[model samples]
Target: MSTRTYLPYIACAAALCVAQARADVKIGFSAPLSGPVAAVGQDQYDGFLLGLESVGGKLGGQVTTVLREDDQLKPELGNQITRKFIDRDKVDAMVGLGFSNVLMASLPRIAESGTVAIATNAGPSPLAGAGCLPNVFSTAWQNDGTAEAMGKYAQDTGFKRVYLMAPNYQAGKDYIAGFKRHYKGQVLDEVYTQVNQPDYAAEIAQLQAAGADAVFVFYPGGMGVNFVKQFSQAGLGKKLPLLSAFTVDGTTLPALRDAALGTISGAMWDVALTTPGNAEFVATFAKKFGRTPSHYAAVGYDAARLLDIAVRKVHGKTADKAAFAAAVKAAGTELKSVRGPFRFNTNNMPVQNYYAFQTVKDGEKFGVKLLGTPLSQHQDVYVAQCGAK
Candidate 1:
């Protein structure tokens, strides 16, 4: 028991404490990585990784460890995974809940744990309104916001009779409702299909028989791919103009390819957008992933950037709850967003432009071309309902 031996033991203990203090930041990412909507989830996850890579795998001078979990696009599964993230993984923050249903199911747990959860997509109405939680923020537009833009465009273009179609779910309902809000036109029919329904033959037949001047739909992920492909196969793509939101984007465009040609959709961002940040993001993302990044990817990248700015502002001391939350809120509009100027509303959902885009052939590949801005500097209606500052 010499003084030299005791001194070495104390030095070792001090080193271990310092190393633990500098531990890597842990972030939990839960999404449907293996399902019909897997493509969308993968795009978001890829974008998240690309953002981290751009910063050399560190945020705010601290290395980050992302714990990814697949919710399989199921609400219950999402809840389970979120609990694991909060209790077992001890994640400081979370990102990437792909669907509204999954997000709704997981939000309570995330809020209860007092962990900040940034939505890369899935801006459900409930969360944007009365159920708004200070801990929840969305880098993406509210579900209804994009659809509302499409609806306004259709109305302005004089589509007197429009047929509406969407999946039978929370987001689907929100899309249709938002569309109807601004469309001030005759509605020939409204159809809601099973979320995972592969065959749209019956729906297409109904659409044709409805005698509508145009059709507005909201189908995401694989459902969008299937619906567009079948609609084209039915020879309806040329006959009837298709208007949609979240139906044709980077995730479904590549798969739909020629079939998606001429389909018009509304989104927060597109590859055709011109900005230094956007150009760099698109070039780097394509070079890294060997494909065009989707709107989903763009939002996911923004979410990562938002987190990085917040972490830096707080000096990586996320343990101080009040300071961390304030930093995150302040960083909302500070980053060089690829979507151009971006800011969060009172609801913590983005208040940005929703552009009209058409799927077209860009040289040898199919891509989105910016048509016009349907909703410029738009704020979600639910923002007024949300009491959060």
Candidate 2:
């Protein structure tokens, strides 16, 4: 009877010690999970969970807890969420920084606290250059990368005059500037519209009057759906060649459908890409979520995989912030990214390929078909300005 009682006590003590040894990995995920852009955030969140599941619901063999927040696509709200993640929850890492504007708003706090942040979308120029932070990394494209690819494609295709349009924001300006860097042609006009503006009759009229050879735009989410639908409604879809980056993607294609067909876009990844493991990722995501995964989802998935490699390398010792950051940076090289040709530059932005894809009818449904790569093994131009030695 004494031996039996003592044996139960010893077993209970061992279980408690094992539990203490495996600490929970806490992650705070913030995104615009409401309003018009909600689909973008939802895809990212779903993909992230899928990735975590692929690793057996643990990141680096540690049980992971994710705190989700919706910023509603507002910078002020994003900043508040960032603060809460850092101050109250004390998350080991943060992801899904939202769009470019929201990311910019939260940049200072992330920079100050030395938090390990992996951006699934919204990589602005400042983060890649003079204002670069050691703890920040983006599994998404730099703001200008896709635009630059479109610009080069226009230049190569002999589109002598191009009209440009985007929402009036930091990303919009960066895209236009990036296009201008490569096009070396006549710019009919650069139009900035209000965010979430539903009407585009005025812009369409301006484009028609300009008589440009092609038009390039950088609208994402609901804005893209509205713009492309209205542009097609204006009867400009056939008359003027439409080109874009993020304006016609999986997120917007379902809404735009036939109207988005024949439109060419610049992107880093798509459901149609044949990169190793991408087909399975696409299939699994579709089966799990009942929707086609966008490039945003791909990035979100990659972000999780990246953290898996990093956290495992450091054995989940994320308390040493600097060491964790270093591990993340090095993880970029080790990961066989679904996007292909991915490695972090000295600035922690991706050096990858950007391709031209055209929306097409895939059997009974709509999808994108790869046209040709516009840029390969490309690093953003701002890397030259980065202070990383």
By TM-score, who's the top model here? 2
Per-residue lDDT of 141-211 in model 2, one digit per residue for the tens? 89999999999999999999999999999899889988888899999899999987888888888898998
Model 1 per-residue lDDT tens digits across residues 257-344? 8888899999989899995689999998999889989988898888888888888998889887567766778898787788877887
**In model 1, which residue pairs have backbone atoms overlapping below 3 Å?**
none
Clashes of each: 0, 0
Per-residue lDDT of 309 in model 2: 92
Error of 1 at 329 (Å): 1.2
The per-residue C-alpha lDDT of model 2 at residue 235 equals: 91
Q: List the residue pairs that clash in candidate 2.
A: none
The global Cα lDDT (0 to 1) of model 2 is 0.87
Name model 2 segments beyond 4 Å from true.
Answer: 1-23
lDDT of predicted model 1: 0.84
